[model samples]
Every structure is written in C-alpha cells, then in structure tokens.
Target chain A: MTSHIDTCGLSCPQPVLLFLTALRKTEAKEFDVLVDNEVSRENVTRAAENHGCHVTAHQEGNDVTRLHIAKN
Target chain B: MKSLRNIFVSPAGIILTGAIIGLLAILLQHYGNPGNMGICVVCFNRDIAGGIGLHRASVVQYLRPEIMGMLLGAFVAALFFGDFRARGGSSPITRFLLGVIASIGALVFLGCPWRAILRLAGGDGNALFGFAGIFVGVGIGTLFFRQGFSLGRNTTQHRASGFVMPLIMLALVLLYLLYPPIAGQEKNGVLFYSLKGPGAAHAPFLLSIGIGLLVGFLAQRSRFCTMGAIRDVILFRHWHLALGLAAMLLAALVANVALGSFKPGFEGQPIAHTQSLWNFLGMVTAGLAFALAGGCPGRQIFMAGEGDNDAAVFILGLIVGAALSHNFDMASSPAGIAANGAVAAIGGLVICLLIGITNIRRGA
Candidate 1:
C-alpha cells in the first residue's frame, strides 16, 4: 500500500518531520508526498533518502512538486 | 538566464549572499551605524518604533532607511522572479505573539541573531553566550518538531493582501523624504529623529538603503536566515544554511581585521553588556521564538516583503514589542539588562514553551 501526505503551503522541517512520522507509523513502504516550495521539496527528499528510502520527484505544476518514496 | 537565476539559490549563491551581507554590514558600521552592528533587525525595528512614536527612547530613535529598503528590495525580487503570492492565514495572532516574544528577547540581549554574529566577528566575547543560548533554544524547539508540532499551513489569499507590507515600506520611505531630519531637532513634522546616540549615528541614507536593498533581494532568492541555519542543522543535520552563517562570520571577521575594529573582550564591547546569564536567557527566548515562528527576524521581513501576510503580522508584533520593551524598561543597554529585562526574558521562554507544547498535533 502507498500512503499519501500533502504538505503544500507548509514550511521546512514540518514537511520533513511529517514524512518521518508517517514513515514510522504507517505499515506501508511507499509514500506520495506533495510539497509547494523548493525548500520543502529538498528537505522531504533528503529525509527520505537518509532513511534509506528510494525517492523520485517531479514537478506537477508551476508551484507544486510531488515525490515518490519507497523503503529500501 | 535560468542558470544564472539558479545560482542565486545554489549553495555557492547562499554563501555569496552571506559574504556580501557581512561585508556590507561592516561597511555600514564604518560609515557610522553603531559598532558591531551592521544589520540588526530587532534593533532597527526598535529604533523604527521609536521613530514612529511607538517608543520614546531618545537615543534609539530613527526612521532607519535600511529597514524600508530591505522590504522594497524583497518586493522587487519577488515580483521579478514570479515568486510573489498573496498567502496567509496560519495562526496569525499566535505568530504575532511569537514576534513580540522574539523582539523582547533580542532586546534583552541587546542584539538579534545577526547582531550576535556581527558582535562575534568584531571580537566581542559576549556573543559566545548568546550563540550558546540560541543553540539550546533551537535544540529544544527541534524536540517539539519531532513530536509533530506545527503552526498549521498558510492558505492563499487575495493579491491585495500581499501588497500591504510593501506598501507600508514605500510609505515609510516617503515619510522620510518629506520629513527629512533637522539638525538639533528630534521632531521633524510627525516623524522622530535622534539628535545624538546610536540612533543618530547612521551611515548616509543612500548607502544604508542601497546595502539593505541588495541584501533583501539576495536573501529573498537565497532564503538566507540566521535561525534557520541552526534549526536546519539541529533538525536534519543539513549544513546548507550553516554555510551562509559560516560565510557571514568569516567575511565579517576579515573585514573587522582589515579595518582595525577587532576588539576582543567580554567588557566594553560597544553597545553590549557583560551579564552572561541574562544574555543566555535572552537569546534562549529569542531563538525559540524564531524557531516557532519559522524564521529569524531578517527572514521574516523578507517573507513579509514577498507577500506573506502571516509574516507581516509577525513584523507588526515585533514593532509593538519593541515599543513595549522601551516603554516598560524591558530592554537592555550597554550597562546591562534593565530591571525587568530578565523577568521578561523568562516570561518569553515560558510563553514559547507554552506555544510550542500547545500547538502539537498528536497522532499526526
């Protein structure tokens, strides 16, 4: 199963912190995360990668970026 | 053009922004903007409060052009870069209270985080305690982050809402031009000007505003923030923001050395005090407030400029808090923290802790 989290309009550390919490609590090994800013995008990716998660990201529009994370 | 724009947000770009700000801040001082204080958001805000009759601190009253210029610069950058958005509605009152606490704490320590770094660069040992307090405060805030604490997310708003702060900045500039200060006069029309003291000692208006605008523009692009530097390191072990800090310190230190203004000691550092405990406690309050509010005062200003109404509210809180500090004797001086300063600092810490704990979302 894949868990989805929307962090659009949220600032740094919040998005990453949310990602980490979801990663820990959920039984799922994959996440589709939405972020609206560059800092949040970079941070959520870094946090996932640091936790040994494989990640792929793509810009969805002018402002929003979506990331796919899978636990290794 | 895209690649060049990308450089402004790159690691080297952030470092370059910091270096330029650090160097220019020193130049601001060399041109008469208080020693060891090139760019202090809290102090400048306090002075602006006084300038606008929000406070009556005679020695610290001026309509600082630097403050106005920064907002304008950021506004220009945001507009040009297509980063401007009219967004806000995340716990604005709470953010305002946080700004008040942040400003009071900074005033208690006699400097904001930027000034603390500049003080260190100018060889003031007193800043060591301030930095330590900030680390501890941010560390504590990080613990709350681990527990899923957030102030909620800002929502999009009407475009007019985004222009308010920049318009205010432009109005202030107009006020300055219309009511230019008169020598030996404290009041020029409705505006206040310092006849003497730190507020009176400023670099040329154009110079101060020019440096401020440049910094504001670059900081908007780089997202340079002092509190964010420490918070990023503590939360994710990320060193991206820390590089900006290191560059600022290094650049400022070298500039001070070349200018022969490097004076190392806990005592007699210009516009500073030697009260170690209060200094630590003051910044402890400030750092936590900044973390809770999600940016340092400088970043808050830039954010406000870029159409963040929440940030604008927070900036208003800072101005009001500055007024309260001076009026109620909660601000510090070169002699030491005022009688109520320590109490205010403790109160600020308690408020921050309350705000931090109460805002947490369990089972997020």
Candidate 2:
C-alpha cells in the first residue's frame, strides 16, 4: 500500500521530477517521499496533485521531512 | 482534509499576503527606493553584480543587500518552517543557458515582468507593447509545451549542491557590509558602487532587505509566479495564477497613485524607452525564454534560495548576461535598443523555438 522515493539531495525541478517518475512506477495506494527540504516538499506536493494525487506532509527533523501522497 | 487545509490555509494565504507585501514594496519605493525603481529583480541583481565588480556600468552599480536578503530570507524561512531541501542535477547547464538568454532578453527590453508592470503603472506607454510581446512569446512556449517539449528530467544529487547559492548570497552580503562603497574610487572592493546615478539610487539597505525577505517568505508560500499565471490560463483556463498577477498590477497601480509616482505617458519614463517594436520583441524573447526555463526571474530566485541548483544557475546566468549586456552594447537604454538588439532578439527566438520543437515527442 506504500511506496517510497528518496529525494534527499536533489534540487528544485528535480525533486518534483523524480517524484513524478516514482509515481509512474508505483501503483501503491499511498506514497511517502523522503525529502531534505521544504521547497521540494511544496513542489512534489504540487506535482502530485497536478497528476491527480493527494498529499499530506509532516516534518521529522531539521533536515528531513516525510510527504504522504495518495493516488486518487 | 490536511491537504486542503494546507492548500487553502497556507498557499492561498501566502498568495494574498504576497500581493499585499508587493503593494508595500511599491509604497516603499514611491516614498524612496534609492532610485526611481520600487522593485526590479533584474536591475537589482545587476547592481549586486556591479557591487561585486562583475561589470562597470557606473551609473547603475551597487551591492544591493535586498538581492542577498531575498535568498537569505527565503533560506531562513525555509529552515524555520522546515522547508529547506537541497536537490539538483536536472539540466543545470541548460537552465544556466536559458537564464543567460532570458536575462539578455530582459535587458534588451530593459526590465523583467515586475518592471514591465511598474513601467505601465508609471504611465510608460511602452510597457503596453512589452506586455503584448510577452503574451505572444508565452503563447509560443505553450505550443511547445503542448508538443511535449521538455528540457529533460533532473536526478537527485548531494545536499552541498543546494547550499551553493545561499553561500554565494551570504558572501555578497558580507562583501557589501565589509567594503561599503567609497566615493570617487574605481575599486571599492570586489565590485564598484556608483556614487551617483541609478546605481546610487536605492532604498535603505535594511528596509530593502526587509521588504525582500517579506516578499520571499510570502512568495515561497504562495507559489506566485507571473509566467505560471499566463501559462496556467493558456493551458488549463485556470485563473488562480491570473488573480495573483492582477493583484500585483492593481496593487502597484493603487500604490503609485497614492505615492504620486504615477506618470501617464511613454515619454520621459524612468529607465525605459519608447521603441514599441523592440519593447514587444524584447519581452517576446524574454517571455519565451522564461517559459522554457520554467519560471519568472523572481520565481527562479526564490527557487534558488530553496535549494534549486538549476535555478541558481539560471540566476547566475542572468547576472552574467547582465554583465555581458553592458559590456557588449546589447542592452537597451532609454534612447532605444542597441544596434544589434533586434537581431539578437530574433536569434533568441529561433534558438528557443528550435529547442522546443526538437525536444518534443511527436506522439507522447
């Protein structure tokens, strides 16, 4: 039910980009993305919805966060 | 429920707040923005570049802390709010190239999207033509996007990749603080600041930086982008982006009126020219390049602050292009476009179109 993408060290367009690619590869009902920054979180979240996915996000530490995106 | 909460509560709030902040920027500039400009992403960047000794356009050189503050403020906000992430490697070189071209286009036209609006608000009839050109350019880019045009996807990289831009901005701020511009000196520090001219004109450092930070924080939250607004409407008939753009124009108009900075004719506009065709062509070139590159100059700067190395490269490209513009006589003056400006604009359009067409997958 869950899939993961490690985007810890990517930049603006790429993190969102990799998330999109990961979305294409997974049919998991829920997806969790591990990112190292807030901008990527926003970008990924936006990209997810643009492709019809819903996202929920939570911060874990100074340099890490988890984004939960569900395929709608 | 959380997604909607974040969307409606955060991003929407950010958009509205950002518009208000933009209004404040106009007001601040009207009262005194160090010069005639209230907010100019490109010109300010050029000033920062000049302060660092990148080029010598004496009348328009200063180490603008607002530029540094934009990146740093965004950095702090992202860090504070748990948003700072550093990831890159998606067509960085291409992004840098696009940035350079975009800057050249902007300089040729003599301003970025924000300046275009400011010019219009100040009663510069020339900006009307420039806005029209921007639409045409964006329309072409939309055609390309529809054709499946893409610069290529980026892959994940190291955290250090993301920190590069912020560090550079920090260094610029340090230089500005340590080596304040001296009157009648060729070498002030790494760069030169004009004792007078447009370079000398600037809002107070702290005030400018404060405004920059406020704008950065709000814009980061809002996802407000000028190009995105036009692109969204063209692609999806969405008005969310359009609303923000309208808000900016409206805010500037009202603020300019209140400040008595609203001039009503094309003649004698500040830092602008009246060559209608070039104005249109210049922005057309700028608009296409911005669309292809993926954001407006301001948006790109905010993105760079949030660890977008590609966007950082684009920002650098703009800085370099600004230097190149003055060095090579490619930039426009209030008098008009330089001799080769039109040719360069046409060349840019051709190159962009070529890239757009070649990269598109025919049946994707």
**Whose DockQ is greatest here?**
1
Each candidate's TM vs. the true structure? 0.95, 0.83
Sum up the clashes in candidate 1: 0
* Model 1 docking category: medium
Q: What is the per-residue lDDT of model 1 for residues B1-364, given as tens digits with 9 covering 90 to 100?
A: 4576679767899899999999999999999899898889999999999999999999999988898888889989988987788789989999999999999999999899999999999999999999999999889999988877888888888999999999999999899999988889999999998988789989998998999899999998888998999998988777878899999999999999999999988889999999999989999999999999999999999999889999999999999999999999999999999989989999999999999999998644
**Best prediction by TM-score:** 1
